[model samples]
Target: MNQTVVSYLAQYEFFDSLLALFGGNQGLLTFVIFMIFCLAIVGMCATIGGLGTYAERKISADIQARIGPNRVGPYGILQFLADGVKMMTKEDVMPFSADKFLFYLAPMLALVGVFATLAVLPFSTGFTLSDMNVGIFYLIAISSLVGVSVFLGGYASNSKWSMLGGMRGASQIISYEIPVTISILAITLLAGGMGFGTISAHQRGLPTNWFIFHNPFSFIAFFVYFVGALAETNRAPFDLPEAESELVSGYHTEYTGMRFGFFALAEYIEVFVVCGVGAALFLGGSNLPVDLSFDIIPLQLVEVVIFMTKALLLYYVVIWIRWTFPRLRVDQLMSICWKYLTPIAIFNLVGCAIWVVLFNGKSVAQLLMGGGH
Candidate 1:
């Protein structure tokens, strides 16, 4: 009951703040504040993608004990900026046979679709842009635009390789989305709520209180979701769309200058978003093991840091996987999805249901206490 009230008041205050900003003479202030907030997030993304590009090479190179990107800047740190400027100054190319309107719009659409999903994501308790009752549903609905945007980019390219990449993206996202859904469903069942705040709050005690610990099935579901998420976002071992040797930049083959930059940035940011969502759903989110209520550091800062830590760590994992593993054949990729992930997800869902009926929180807790011999 106490938890219920806190959630209501937090959501009410958030809505009131937004409504008040637009309803009064503070409209201009609201607009500027909103723009700044969005710009901050964008700026952070740019920095991550830019610097992260260099970091990926450096880390991967160090593991192999070879020199990496040393000439571009100190430890090759400035390489990303150089790459940005180079991309910016490059001549824009549009194929004469391409659909010019869509060719130009595709990258922007992809970026928009990818970035827009961040709006509903809660960084920490009482700290999202807006905590809609249907936040999860909103995320799902908005994220599906990635598929449409990929299709548009591919179809507009007027190149067979580009079209093939787009189609592969379409199929890959669709296939992986199933296991992702199943994994997320596991969380919803355990938390008994859909809003991210509620889920985060439900695990307030220790890291062990995370939904990932609610049942054995949920723990497995988390890994299943993480794997599918890699596939869904077209990252690393799953990045067939941009197979450098085969497709020479794939769906955005004709994109140049800043247009290509946007596509590249979107892909990286999407990587961050998916991993962040995973952390929030299964890893106890912003609730640190310590008492958050008493933390001297701002809660928002801690939340963002914890959230980003999870995302970036996952990002590194993706890079490692990319460097270590060869791409699977298209047929093998589909078989892994249908034969392995999908069936396992279905079994996990059923297992969770049975676990809940036979031995939920109380029973499990008792067993841990050595009560039910």
Candidate 2:
């Protein structure tokens, strides 16, 4: 197995040498490092969620032909900070009829499920937190937990609207996962592995080499995956769970203060996670179109920036979509997932497999162009 970034750094004597200066035991040092990494992930996710809110609002305002946050701090960059403080200082109210335990448990569960999938995210060639062999499979399994959390949050709220919203969320997410998995499987077949790193490494640096443009089937599969992902994240068009016009804030209806914030944060963070995975699988993740060998800055950092840029572009699309599209009814959401996306995804998967067998892993673009580039 290839060494992960952390393991690579440790064995190269960087971590050991640094820790030795602190006179810490190996186990202590390991634990401390692990904790720091965990903190970093949490901090990163929370920070993204914070800034993402501002970005989304600004984007929405721009789409509607209005100026966005310009008061909080130059161009309202600090608006999210003010929003965070407001949410923090707000009352943490709970409905008397709510199931206290489950109510409290829901947000944590939602956050945990979303964050846990970060393990398999290959930020760059060697920068993943955990590069498991079953990386994609693990991601599918863990992400399903978000549905359960949504359901619990709604059910525990003891409100009719909340319960209905939770039910919709659970059904929507669970149904969507089917297409998402099959769509990803299309890429897995082409890559011949499930690891995020492996899949990314299979692609070349050029846009033509990206999986979305690899073949007809893969191209179709990318749309299928993208649709499934939007539903999975409870984004617009598929956002019946929190359809304010109907459900009055959905599953987290009764939640207040940080509890409500957790749900919101988890939702936004999941948006990035899905976008990251999409970039890794379909875009030439972290791969520059042309190589630049710079001695001062590592290639890994460059790759990370490239990968994030792709993901961020996708993330911007998600926000754009939320503001542009109207929410689909529950029936429409189900029909699209079960009748359209799932079958298309399955066919795409099978078609991709056949393409791989016939083309011997060469992309259509590569095969047509006589490939030596």
Candidate 3:
């Protein structure tokens, strides 16, 4: 599997031809190419964000035994377009009492943070925008910007409920990140690297080979990561920051029209990004259930479909959870993170290290089936 995928990427003739134009200035050429890739990713994220809202509404409607959206296009597929038009046409209102600069800057900052994580994602073999060595660490760092933006959005709003929501969101995201980072490190320890492509590349060619089944500790880490990610992204059961019952509209209470749309877009994009990260780290990312030699279509196309299917499955689950679970109280949310999830995540990280040493890097499935390849 490695030889097939890695070899193709290494000898990518198109990329090689592009590199030839740079001659001695390969670094600049790489930077230029990366920027172009980032632009594409931004567009992709925005499109996904719009589609995600439609999916959310439809799924929630089904769960609640309703029709969801059926007005615009077939089965309301064009509802997102209608929503976008509404947002753009609606009044762009800013309270006279609010700080104009921070109010405007907050949504942009949040949007940047979530979308930037896409840069390091390995969409498929040889299809990463920029596979940085410290990719996982880079994702953690960039995502913290969400907290900053939330806080600024709240404080700049000049509304007490907005301020409280912002503060809570900041605290919740920062606290959950501790467990999130540790859980990710558990996978990194197993993969023996921080690059996402490197980590995903280590997954073997079967469902049993996925890291989620690597060991009991890695298994626990998967759930821990899932829970922490829910909190980090302000999903239900941990959505205290935007608790409509208590905080009006939460951090973006004073925002309207396009500014509010930005916040919504960022939130939805973060949902997919977190789920995608979960897929890459725990599932056999972009790997098929059975290894198939590419004959008709390119291997990268097949791999991308597999990867997105896994990611979107998780994304669907997130939506399901949102409609099923009730939001937790702020105190309960904090207690869950600090008193339970963080400690358990730490233990899983340690246990994974010990398991790796004892098993000599073999996954549980490998041990159960026979010995390592």
- Top-TM-score structure, candidate number: 2
**lDDT of each structure?**
0.77, 0.87, 0.87
Q: If ranked by lDDT, best first, what sequence of candidates would result?
A: 2, 3, 1
Cα lDDT tens digits, model 3, 199-235, are 8778848788899988999999999999999999998
Superposed by TM-score, candidate 3 places the C-alpha of residue 314 at a distance from the truth, in angstroms, of 0.5
CA RMSD of each candidate after superposition: 3.9, 2.2, 3.2
Ranking by TM-score: 2, 3, 1
Write the residue-wise lDDT of candidate 2 on 124-150 in tens digits.
Answer: 766677777899899989988899999
Question: What is candidate 1's CA lDDT for residue 139?
Answer: 79
In order of appearance, the predictions have TM-scores of 0.88, 0.94, 0.92
Model 1, total clashes: 0
Off by over 4 Å in 3: 1-10, 14-36, 290-297, 371-373
- Cα lDDT over the full model 3: 0.87
Could you tell me the lDDT of residue 128 within candidate 2? 75
